[model samples]
Target: PALRSIVNPDDARFLNPPDMPKAIQAFCRETRQPAPRTEGELVRCAYESLALKYREVLGWLEELTGNCIEVIHIVGGGSQSAILNQFTADACQRPVVAGPVEATAMGNLLVQVRASGELATLAEMREVIRKSSKVAVFKPGPAAAWEDAATRFAGLRRGN
Candidate 1:
């Protein structure tokens, strides 16, 4: 919010075309906005920007596949960040299912189990994961703000 007040929220962009810190500084310089000086601002900017990128990629997927993705299931360590999960839900206007922070380890164990012929198929592994894991669901909130943010991100990506 403080950062928004300092610059046109409409000018916000995802800062990943370059590496993180450099991209953020470059973007701030290009937009004539002050660079984020505090850890909170930097973290907020990165999280929000990532959420916008996720929305963009999801849109591309829907366009290319002719399928509507209703929910985003985020497994792995990244799913542990509730802030990111909420931001993703807001940005994508979709419910986000986040859990199994140890997804990689779980999958490795499952693969071994499957190789041993205890698990029959991928579906069986998924069922076991579902039964054993606890997941949190984040529902999309009011989307007007995120819609505006997305527009800004899109414009930035296009070098507008």
Candidate 2:
């Protein structure tokens, strides 16, 4: 994940932070927990938390779609997180594909290309993605523990 409020997009933040590892460290300090100083630990915390939130969102998506999700595609700067992608696969119990870190621009370009008749169909767009960009595919792993972590995480949030 990256910084938000960059003039075009604005979004909001804590422990198990979705972004800002520094903020996560601060939260840990406030709670008398050891701060995550290493990159791996900080990233892990963020991934785990983000995975839980994504699972929650998927629950709503299922309600809207009225079916089980088949696959997930994560595109953007945040998609660069292998840890996050793996966690998403595990927690969401679905395959997660991440790629084209600059997907915003690429997707915009594709829309323009399609408008110009250079491409057609969403399937064709994805084929372009496969041939033209590097993607990381993550399969779901054991997620039983994530539920407990998520519950504790929710408690931390409720205290706020």
* Top lDDT hit: 1
Residues 1-160, candidate 2, lDDT per residue (tens digit)? 2211011001134323456766777666654556777786766665666777787689889999999888999999988888779888887889998988989998899999999999879999989988999988999977767666556555555552
lDDT of 1 by residue, 12-117 (tens): 3532344555567667668665677667777787788778889989999999999999999999989999998998999899999999888999999999999999
Question: How many Å off is the CA of 101 in candidate 1?
Answer: 0.9
Report lDDT (CA) for all predictions: 0.80, 0.71
- Tell me the TM-score of each prediction against the true structure: 0.84, 0.71
Alpha-carbon runs more than 4 Å astray in model 2 = 1-26, 29-39
Would you give me the overall lDDT of model 2? Answer: 0.71
lDDT of 1 at 120: 95
Evaluate residue 26 in candidate 1 and report its C-alpha lDDT on the 0 to 100 scale. Answer: 61
Clashing pairs in 2: none
